[model samples]
Target: MLTEVKNQIKVVFLSIKYSVMRELLNRFTFISNVIFMMLNNASMIIQWLVLFSLRENMGGYTFKEVLLLWGIASSTFGFSRFFFYKAFSLSSIINEGKLDSYIVQPKNILISIITSDISVSALGDLLYGYIMLVFYGLSIKSFLLFTYFIITGGIIIAAISVILNSLSFWFGNTDVIAETGNHLMTNFATYPDGIFKGIAKALLFTLIPVGISNYIPVHVIVNFDLNLFLINTTVCIFLIYFAFITFYTGLKRYSSSNLMSSKI
Candidate 1:
C-alpha cells in the first residue's frame, strides 16, 4: 500500500514536471495567456472598485467583505484555470479528433486531455487574491474558522470546474455552458450569498451553488459557528466526490469518432 501511494505521488510529480517543460518550450502561448489574464483581472478590479465607491455596501457586504469574497473566488478560479483548463476545453479535443491519439497513449486519457492546455493568466488573479485574503485574514479574530472556510471554499471551486468539464462528454458543445458557469461563479463569488432570497438562495445553494461554495461558508466561518462550518465543509467534500464519480460514469459511455458510422 505504501509503495502504491509513493508511485502515485511519483506520477503526479512527473506530470507536473512534464507540464512545466512543455510550457517552457511553448513560451509564446504562455506569454499570451499571461497578457490576456492581466487584462481580464484589471477589468474585474476596476469594476469592483467602482461598485465599492458607489455604495456603502452592496447587499449588506462592505467593500472589505466583497474583497474577501473576490479573493477567495479568484484564488479558486485561478487554481481551476491553471490545472483544469485542459479539461474545461474537452469539446475542442473531441471536435479535432485529439482524443484519437490520446486513446492510444498508455497514460490516463482524461488527465492528458485536461493537462494539454494551461492558462497562465490565472496567476494574476491568484496573486491579487492572496493579497486580499491575507489582509482580511489578519483583521479577523478566528483563525481556525477562517482556515476551514478557505479549505472548503477551494473544494467547492474545484467541484464546479470538474462538474462542468465532465458535461462535455454528453453535450459535445459545452463551451456555452462552461462560459455561463464561469459568469455565474464569478458573480456569485463577488458578493454575499445572503443577498439572495427564497428560490434564488436555494438555486445558489444547489444547482449553481457558487453561493454556498464561497460566500455562505465564509459567512458562517466568520461567525464562528461549529455546526454551519461543518455542514459547509461536508457539502464541499460531497460535491468534490460527486463530481469525480459523475465524470467517471460519463466516461464509461465516452465514444470517439472511430466509433461513429459513415452515412450511406
Candidate 2:
C-alpha cells in the first residue's frame, strides 16, 4: 500500500516536471504570462483601495485583512492551476472519450490526469500571494498558517473541479455545469464574505463552498481559531475523497471512442 502511494507521488511529480519543461521551451512567453497575471491581480487592489478610502472597513474586513483575503484566494487559485489544471478538462476528456489512455495506466487515474498539465501564469498568482502576505504582516506563526490554508484551499479547489467535471461521466455533455462551477469558485473567492447575505452566504458555505476555501481561511489567518481550522480541514478531506469516489464510480459507465460506431 505504501509503495503504491509512493509510486503515485513520483508519477505526479514527474508529470508536473515534464509539463514545466515543455512550457519553458518558450521562455519569453512563460515569463510574460506570469508577469502579466501578477500585474492583473495587482490592478484589482485598486478597487479595494478606492472603497477603503471611503470607509474604514468593507464587509467587516479592514484593508489589511482584505489584502490577505485576496492573497489566500489567489494562492489557492494559483496552486490549483499550476498543479491540477487538467482537472478542469475532465468534462472534455470524458465526453470525447479520451480517458481510456489513463485507465490503462498503473497510476491513480484521477491524479494522473489532473497533474499532467501546468499553467505558467498561475506561478505569478502564487508568488503574488506571498507578496500580499508580506504586506499583511510577516510572522513565524502567520507564515505557517498562511501556507497551510494555501495548500488546503488549493486542494479544495481542485477537488471541487473534479467533482463538477466528473458529472460528465453520467450526464452526457455537462460542459455548461462544469463551466459555471469553475466561474463560481473563482469569482466568489476573491470577495470578503461579510458582503454575501442570506442565500449567497448559505451557498458559499454549502453548495458553492468559497466559505471553506477562502473566507474561513482568511478569518483563521487573521486570528487563529481551532474549530474553524478543523472544520475546513474536514471539508477538504471529504471533497477530495468524494471527488475520487464519484469519478471512478462514474467511470464504470463510460463509453470509449473505440466503442463508437459510424451511424452511416
Candidate 3:
C-alpha cells in the first residue's frame, strides 16, 4: 500500500513537472502570463481601497480581513488552476468523449487527466496569495496555516469541480452547471462570508461550498482553533474521497467516443 501511494505521488509530480516544462519552453510568455494575472488580481485592490476609504467596514470585513480573503481566494484558485486546470474542462472531456487517452493510461485516470495540463497565469494567483498573506501578518504559524489552507482549499475546489462536472454521465451535457458552480465558488470566495446571510450563506457552505474552501480557512487562520482545524481538514478529506468516488462512478457510465488522440 505504501509503495502504491508512493508511485501515485511520483506520477503526480512527474506529470506536473513535464507540463510545466512544456510551458517553460517559452520562458518569456510564461513570465508574462504570470505577471499579467497578478496585475489583474492586484487591480481589484483599488476598488476595495476606495470603498474602505468611504467607511470603516464592508460587511464586517476590515481591509486586512478582506486582503486575507483575497489571499485565500486567489491561492485556492491558483492552486487548482496551476495544478489541475484540466478539471475545469471535465464537462467537455466527458461530453465530447475525450477520456480515451486517460482511460488507456496506467496511472489513475482522474490524476492523469487533471495533471495533463499546467496554467502559467495561475502561478500569479498563487504568488498573489502568498503576498496577501505577508500583508495580512506573516508568521511561522500563519504561513503554515496559509499553506495548509491553499492545499486543502484547492482540493475542495477540485473535488467540487469533479462532483459537478461528473454529472455529465447522467445528463448528456452539464457544462452550464459546472461553469456556474465554478463562477459561484470563485466569485463568492473573494468577499467576506459575513456579508452573506440566510439562504445565501447556507448555499455557500453546503451547495456551493465556498465556505469550506475559503471562508472557514480565512476565519480559522485569522484566529486559530484546534477543533475547527480538525473539522475543516476532515471535511476536505471527505471531499477528496467523494470526488474520486464520483468520477469513477461516472466513469462506469462513460460511453467512449473512441476518438483517436495523442497525449504526448
Candidate 4:
C-alpha cells in the first residue's frame, strides 16, 4: 500500500511538472494570445456585471456563486484549450490529411496532436476564474472541492472531445458537430445546471457531464454530502477510462487512406 501510494504521488508530481513545462513553452508562442486573454477576462467581468444588474441572485445562488461559477468555468475552458486545443480541431486534422504526420512520429499520436496546439489565452480564463473564486469567500473545503471540480471537468471535456473527434474516423468532416458540442459544454459549465430542467438537465449530467463540473459538486458543497462527492468522483474516474477506450477504439478505424488521407 505504501509503495502504491508513493508511486501515485510520483505520478502526480510528474504530471504537474510536465504541465508546468507545457505552460512555460506556451509563453513564447504568438502575441495574439495576449489579446485573446484580455478579451476573455473582460468577458468574465462583463458577465458578472450583467447578472448582478438584473438581480442579486438567480435561482438559489447569489452573485457570489455566479462569480465563482464563472471563474471555474473560464478556468476549465482555458485548461481544456491549453492542453487539448488539437482535440477541438480533430476533424480538421483528420480532414486536412495532417494526421499522417502524427502517424509517422514515435510518440502517441493523440497526445502529440493535442499538446502541439496549446492555447495560453485560456490561462487568462483560469486566472480570472481563480480570482473570482477567491473573492467569493473560498474556504479550505471549497478549495479542495474546486480542485476536484477542475480535474473532473478536464476529464469530461477530454472524453467529450475524443468522442467528437472519433466521428472523423467515419465521417468526412465534423466541424459543425465539434463546434456545437464545444459550445454546449461551455454553456453548461458557465451556468448552474440546476437552472436546466427535465431533459436538458438530464443531458448535461449524462451525455455532457458538465453538471459534475460545478452543479452537482457545488450542490454537494453547499449541502454537505459525502455520498454525492464519492459518487461524482467515481463517475469522473469512470468517464476518464471511458474516454480512453473511445479514443483507442477510434484509433483502430483510423486508416491511411491513399498516401495522404488518414487520422493518426
- What TM-score do all the candidates reach, one by one? 0.76, 0.96, 0.96, 0.78
Candidate 1 Cα outliers beyond 4 Å, as residue runs:
1-6, 25-43, 46-54, 94-116, 137-155, 257-264
lDDT of 3 by residue, 103-220 (tens): 8877789888887887899999999999999999999998999999899999899888888898999997887998888898898899888888999999988888888889888888
lDDT of 1 by residue, 1-264 (tens): 787657645655576567667776878887777667656755776786887788787787777777677777776677666655665666555544456666676555555556555566776665556666675665545444555565576556656666776677777767677667767877777767757899988888787877666776567645666677667878887987887786677676676665553211
- RMSD list, candidates in order: 5.1, 3.3, 1.3, 4.6
| Clash counts for the predictions, in order | 1, 0, 0, 1
lDDT of each: 0.66, 0.91, 0.89, 0.70
In model 4, the worst 10-residue window by lDDT is: 255-264
Clashing pairs in 3: none
The TM-score that candidate 4 achieves is 0.78
Q: lDDT at 126 for candidate 2?
A: 93
Q: In candidate 4, which residue pairs clash?
A: 71-129
Question: Ranking under lDDT, best-scoring first?
Answer: 2, 3, 4, 1
Selected candidate, larger TM-score, 1 vs 2: 2
Candidate 4 residues 219-257, lDDT tens each?
Answer: 765677887787778877886677667666767777654
- Local accuracy of candidate 2 as per-residue lDDT tens digits, 1-264: 999999999999998899888888999999999999999999999999999999998889999999999999999999999999988888988988887778899889999989888989999999899999999998998899989999999999999889989999889888788889989999998888999999999999999999998999889988889999999999999999999999999999989897553311
Those runs of model 3 whose alpha carbons end farther than 4 Å from true positions after fitting are: none
Residue 241's lDDT within candidate 3 is: 94
